[model samples]
Target: MSSSRRLTTVGFDADDTLWQNERFFRITERHFAELLSDHADHDHLSERLLEAEKRNLRLYGFGVKGFTLSMIETAIEVTEGRVPARTIELILQAGRDMLSHPVETLPGVRETLERIAGTHTILLITKGDLFDQERKLAQSGLGELFDGVEIVSDKTRTTYERIFAQHGDGAARAMMVGNSLKSDVVPAIDAGGWGVHVPHELTWVLEHVEPPTEHPRFLAIDHLGELSAIVEAIG
Candidate 1:
């Protein structure tokens, strides 16, 4: 990092980086598989659903509603238009349940944020459906810790650059900590910010990417518990 960079603002990724998100999606996916098990095998159904999700990213963006639609689309495709209306209803209900599921923060999240909040301007930078993200943030009860909250459609280099410059000194002085190397780390590092990856147990397949091991601004930690120390060392 350049001497001009002092790690002024720390941008955190919300989904699995802060609280449990992908697990609910997984749970719903299992229900979806069961709903159509007689029509299609589990592995086949899952593959079809993942493909639908990837395809629908642009149309639906990211969130429970899009996932629900994808599940419905997969069910329809696998059944060749014979998917029962009742089954489709059940799939819709599963997505509703996911939306209402409890928000569970990862271990050490609150404590780690508390330790660093006073020292740095922290922001919640996550991409997803606006209303649901807001609901989760409100439910997580960690909302107050963030100086700013950005629920975006996607994470890109320009997104990191603009957000960091607006909230902090600039991208070079900002640190983005999240679970996805593609969404959280690479783009942030590309924008001249430090990228700190905290791997989550269940990341979406679309988010999978090779780590930028040779990038001077890239760093990885086992968990959010290790974040504050990295920030301190950079300062």
Candidate 2:
């Protein structure tokens, strides 16, 4: 813990932390690579898409819609605007499939949230399209468990500071739990909040970053089930 005051508020990242998210994107990316094989090689198309996504992160932010748009742009670029209409249709279908996919909550997420809700103020602080994220929350059946939900354009130190300030007094008594080091853990720690990194199996490359090992409040746990114990220990 960074402060003497015990953690009073906990913020959870939605995708890949509480539920299965990146896997769907990965699957769709593979499907996309296959669809564009005539235009470019699988590896080349994959790299181009990733580059496009990164370049458009500012304009598009993070979400399935942004990803879908990036895929379209990448297709056009890689094929020199010669991508077949049928192939474009398949890409759009893949995006719709991702949007409509079932929300699969990760193991122990609901149970852990249920346990901790009794003691702390919980918030779902995730970044993505507002309607899409809200829909996912409704589908996840975990929306009622949170004190509030924030759908933001991006996750950064300033974002965490603002969220904690609004939800409570400051990050002094808050802890952020999520799977992305860049978006969840690092920025939370930078904002003076404790950060717990719960690693996911398939993480997006843009969200990848080295863990802050020397930080006093940084904790890495394999599973979210261990969060209750950490909260208790912090108290």
Candidate 3:
């Protein structure tokens, strides 16, 4: 226990933290890599795609659509603007498939969220492409569980500060739960709020970062189900 004051509100991350999101993108990328093998080595294509994504993050921000566009551009560049129509179709289909697919909430997420709903003011705080995130949230059926929902372009230190200021008037009484150390935990801590880290099995490389030292306000758990007990114990 870091503080004697109980948490009054809980903030949760949407993608990967509460639902299965990244795995779908990873599968699509693997297929894209296979398609490019004839034109370029897998390693080379992957590196190029990664570089494109890095650049696109600044220009396009995060989402499957931007990723699909990046793949299309990479294919054109790799094949000298002679990429076959079918290959281009495949890239486009990947993005469409992601949008059409039903959002799959992780096991125990709904149960845990439902369990804690009455005890805390739950807010869904996620950052990404607005349309994509909204679509997923609508389909997930978990949107109704939240008191508030935020779709941010980026999760920076300032973003967290603003979030807390807006939602967590009593900074000492707020908590954030999520999978990314960079976007979720670090910024939450910096903004003077407690952070509960629920790590996912396949964290994206770009989102990876070191954890903070053992602090009263920092707690890590294996799954969302553990949240109830952890909150009860701390409070």
Candidate 4:
């Protein structure tokens, strides 16, 4: 990084980055597969659901609403339009349950944020349903720690550039920390910002990507607990 550029702001990705998220979706997915297992094979049902999610990304985007719709679509497809009304109702109930799931902050997230809060401009830049993301933030009781909150439709290099400039000094003065390499890290790196990959146990398949090995500003850490050290070293 250039001398003119010092880490001034850190953008954190929500969902699996700050709190437990994907696991709930996975759990519901398994339930969905079981719901339609009598009509379609379990493995095939899972495959179809994944396909529906991919296909619906453009139309519905991310979050529980999209996931729910995808589940319904997958159920109908796998069951060849013969999916029982009771099963559909059960799927709807599952979606509602997901939407209302308690927000559980991942280990070390609050402490890490508190450590860096006073020093850096901490921004929450996550992609998903706007209301759900906001609700999760409100429920997590960590909204006050963030300088800004961005619920984006997507995360890309251009998006990172724009956001970093808007909330921080610029892309060069920003660092993005998250679990998704494709959405969080790689794009930030391409935007001339630091990319910190903090691996989460259950990552969405679509969000997986190879980390840039030779990038000087790219880093991989075990968890959010290590972030303060990175910021300190950068300073």
Candidate 5:
């Protein structure tokens, strides 16, 4: 935590950290529920969509397209193919809209990035479906702020180790900032880097995990903007 030993390379998580992502999917799912209301129970349809998403994560991975396909499959199953062609069109359109939608950075994201960019080698490290993450980074317009952008399929201790090695940085000189404790913090600390947890209000349940206590390298903040102070303190 010494200023001289402060982090030089900063790693960031993408979804729910740099931008508003998950909420949009949640809103679209509600619209999808409305579309199938006449054909199936709302709760039942929601459950089906969730189930399909879980199954498809293993098959197709995560993204808007997979979710759209899940909705279509759910419709076909629940309605016994009674779903009209127009309804299917609406579902597809919803997915397209989600993909094409403008990226909205969370409060303080741009300012914070701009403030920290000059002092650190900023790298965007995110895990998800490949194309979806690429499209999102293109839409964000803040891609230039990062020194590098990585779209990873998974986040684990080994993944961070690989990333740090690829960046040619010692683990002690690397720092990770993210919203998910499970995906972002644990592996980062385990890999011998500093972990900063910036909890988002709408975190997905699957991404939730308790942080380890008595760790000298683990820092937690309620807001993204608080990072500047911590970095400055460490520096």
Candidate 6:
């Protein structure tokens, strides 16, 4: 860790960190399972859909399009190619609905970002399909708060290092705040930046990981409201 880690750059994860995201997925997933209820049980359908999503991540990356495709794939697999065309159309519509769904910024997101915007360089570092991510950011109305907005294919140690260095001082002088311990917290900590986790009510299974309870650079908060105090204390 940098001895002079004064928190120059602040990076926030999108999706469930800044606003609601996973909940929408869960909603659509339920609808998907219902559509396939005749063919498979809910648990079996959910398991298969998750497996498909994990497998197709490399090919399709992360976004509604990829998820819808995975759901369609799962439906076909479960029904042995007997899934109705009407069901497929409904699945496609569900994805479209998600794409157009309203963005709901989490509590204290705007206030905290505004409180720090003038004091420190802030960047939005998120990974997903560029279009959907951009749509959500634009809809969230927090776009102007960010000094830089990076939509990457994925989040990793190198990604954090490169982004923090480019957008602010460097990884050592930066802090990442978000909901996912895997993508938002651990990678930033690994790159020698402070990781402040603001856990959300709901999160995707793939994004869950063991918390870094023993890391000196890691801090976990219950909400975004506490972030300003943490930053001030660090300063």
Give the whole-model CA lDDT for all candidates, comma-separated.
0.93, 0.92, 0.85, 0.92, 0.85, 0.92
TM-score between candidate 4 and the true structure: 0.97
Candidate 5: regions farther than 4 A off? 1-4
For 43-149, candidate 1 gives per-residue lDDT tens digits of 99999999999999999999999999999999889999999999988998898898888899999999999998988889999999998999999999999999999
Off by over 4 Å in 6: 1-5
Instruction: Report the Cα lDDT for residue 25, model 1.
Output: 89
For all predicted structures, in order, the TM-scores are 0.97, 0.96, 0.93, 0.97, 0.89, 0.97
Q: Write the per-residue lDDT of candidate 4 for residues 77-152, one digit (tens) a residue.
A: 8778988899889999999999999999999999999888878889999999998999999999999999999999
The CA lDDT at 60 in model 3 is 88
Supply the global lDDT for candidate 4. Answer: 0.92
Count the clashes in each prediction. 0, 0, 0, 0, 0, 0
- Model 4 residue 71 CA deviation (Å) reads 0.8
Candidate 3 local lDDT, 1-235, one digit each (tens)? 1334477778899999999988998888889989888899888988888888988998888888789989998999899899999999989988899888888899899999998786777888998889889999999999899988889988877777777667655546778899999888888887778888899988878888888867768889989999999877766
The deviation in Å at residue 206 for candidate 5 is 2.5
Model 2 pairs whose backbones collide: none
Residue 86 alpha-carbon offset, candidate 3, angstroms: 2.7
Q: 79-149 in candidate 5: lDDT tens per residue?
A: 89899999999999999998888888888988888888878778899987787888888888889998888
Better of 2 and 5 by TM-score: 2
Residue-wise C-alpha lDDT for candidate 2, range 78-98, written one tens digit per residue: 989999999889999999998
Which digits, one per residue and each the tens of the lDDT, describe model 6 over residues 84-200? 999999999999999999999888889999998878889999988899999999988899989999999999999999999898888999999999999999999999999998988
